[model samples]
Target: MQTNMFKRLKRTTRTALGFACLLIGIVFILLPGPAVIFIPLGLALLSLEYDWAKVWLKKSQKYFRQAAVKADQALHWFGKKLRN
Candidate 1:
């Protein structure tokens, strides 16, 4: 069926993107930019088929959560005004 063919294509594309993201993440780590950013993304993509990626995604999610919390705290502190 045509629909079946489309599904296969979609899966293939997902797998490819997952690998690409992982490679980009590694490259970013040595060069510049937020390397951690791509790790989660790569894991997310890989998680579609692999169990290991799920674990990695969980870890990456935690890191992002912590970073968000820190950013929120920093913003709140900066927003506070000195009161008499």
Candidate 2:
């Protein structure tokens, strides 16, 4: 019983901290600082306990990768056109 309570308390604390970080990150997005940085970090922490967060994390990663690829392609095209 004692051990179980301690485990439960620890889990709750982790969840609370993760949630707080997620909210703060969201707020920071509209205010200032590197919001993109915090969002992934929050998702990472929340992923530890929530399936929804895990799904979002994967989606965010995929989106960022796609954006990066597009940016690279655009840069290459721009450079080629400049050379021509």
Candidate 3:
């Protein structure tokens, strides 16, 4: 019984925090803040209790990875151009 209560409390806390982060992230999209960081963080927290969040989190991870690769390539190209 104690464990069940603890689990419920934990889930509720997680859900509240997840929603808070997601909402903040959305707000950051319109305003000036770190949406990239918060969105993924919210998704990660929500993913602990929700399947949809998990799916979105995976997609976000892939997109970020691709963006990172492209950014790295661009920097490499810029460095090479400077040398020449």
Candidate 4:
């Protein structure tokens, strides 16, 4: 029916957009753009329709969290050193 056709169209559009963002993110990785943002955004969008993207998105989230913790620690340590 029309509903099924609409669903298919929506899925196709989402997939195309997700892949476009993902590819742009990959390119940005080497060109000094916002790869970090776009990559997760793409994964998030793709995850809405794909299990594989969901897995990868989870892993990326974990890695970003760890990186944030490390960066925060480094900043605190640096601030303490400056005070001494």
Cα lDDT for residue 52, candidate 4? 100
Q: In model 1, which residue pairs have backbone atoms overlapping below 3 Å?
A: none
> Candidate 3 has which clashing residue pairs, if any?
none
Rate residue 28 of model 3 by lDDT. 100
| Candidate 3 lDDT, 1-84, residue by residue in tens | 999999999999998999899999999989999988998999999999999999999999999899999999999999999999
Which lDDT tens digits does candidate 1 get at residues 6-70?
98898888778998998898899899977787878888988997898899889889988999999
Q: Write the per-residue lDDT of candidate 2 for residues 2-51, one digit (tens) a residue.
A: 99999888778777877887788789978987667777787887898889
Q: What are the TM-scores, per candidate, against the unseen true structure?
A: 0.67, 0.71, 0.83, 0.93
Residue 69: error of model 1 in Å? 5.5
| Stretches of candidate 3 exceeding 4 Å from the true structure | none
Considering lDDT, where higher is better, how would the candidates rank from best to worst? 4, 3, 1, 2
Tally clashing residue pairs in candidate 2.
0
Can you tell me which runs of candidate 4 are displaced by over 4 Å? none
The reply for model 2, stretches above 4 Å from the true place, is 71-84
Q: State residue 24's C-alpha deviation in candidate 1, in Å.
A: 0.4
Ranking by TM-score: 4, 3, 2, 1
- The global C-alpha lDDT for each of the candidates, from Candidate 1 onward, is 0.86, 0.85, 0.95, 0.95
